[model samples]
Target: MLYPSNYVNKIIYRIKWVTQKNIEAVENKALKKEELKEKIRKNSSVNG
Candidate 1:
């Protein structure tokens, strides 16, 4: 079987795109968690 070069390039590019999206999702989730922790710390200090 034979495939076109553009077809193969498109597949590779899509794979990279998906991997990058997943990485960004993970980083965003981690960043949100850190922000939440900071907020909780600030609230606790104020409440005390």
Candidate 2:
């Protein structure tokens, strides 16, 4: 009854939180990769 509802809500909230965190982490990693690629491109063009 009441306990089950509370437990379900808590579980859902935690799942949502973890999912959002994982999405954000992936987005950040993609951004860093892009930045590194840009840096490498710039350096290669300079040396070549």
Candidate 3:
């Protein structure tokens, strides 16, 4: 059986694309967590 020359490369490219998307999602979550921590600190300082 013969396959197209770039078929394997295309598959790898798709996998990379999916991984990048997941990484971005996690990064966004971490950023939000940091922002929440900052807000809590500010609120506690103001109240105390």
Best-matching candidate per TM-score: 2
Q: lDDT score, residue 3, model 1? A: 95
Query: Model 1 misses residue 43 by how many Å?
Result: 0.4
Which stretches of model 2 miss by more than 4 angstroms? Answer: 1-3
Model 2, span 1-48: residue lDDT tens: 356888999999999999999999999999999999999999999999
The residue ranges of model 1 lying beyond 4 angstroms of the native Cα positions read: none
lDDT digits (tens) for residues 1-48 of candidate 3: 867869978988999999999999999999999999999999999999
Give lDDT: candidate 1, residue 46. 100
| lDDT of every predicted structure (CA atoms) | 0.99, 0.97, 0.96
Clashes of 1: 0
TM values, all candidates: 0.87, 0.89, 0.80
By lDDT, the best candidate is: 1
Candidate 3, which ten residues in sequence have the lowest lDDT sum? Answer: 1-10
The best-first sequence of candidates by lDDT reads 1, 2, 3
Better of 1 and 3 by lDDT: 1
Q: What is the lDDT of residue 43 in candidate 2?
A: 100
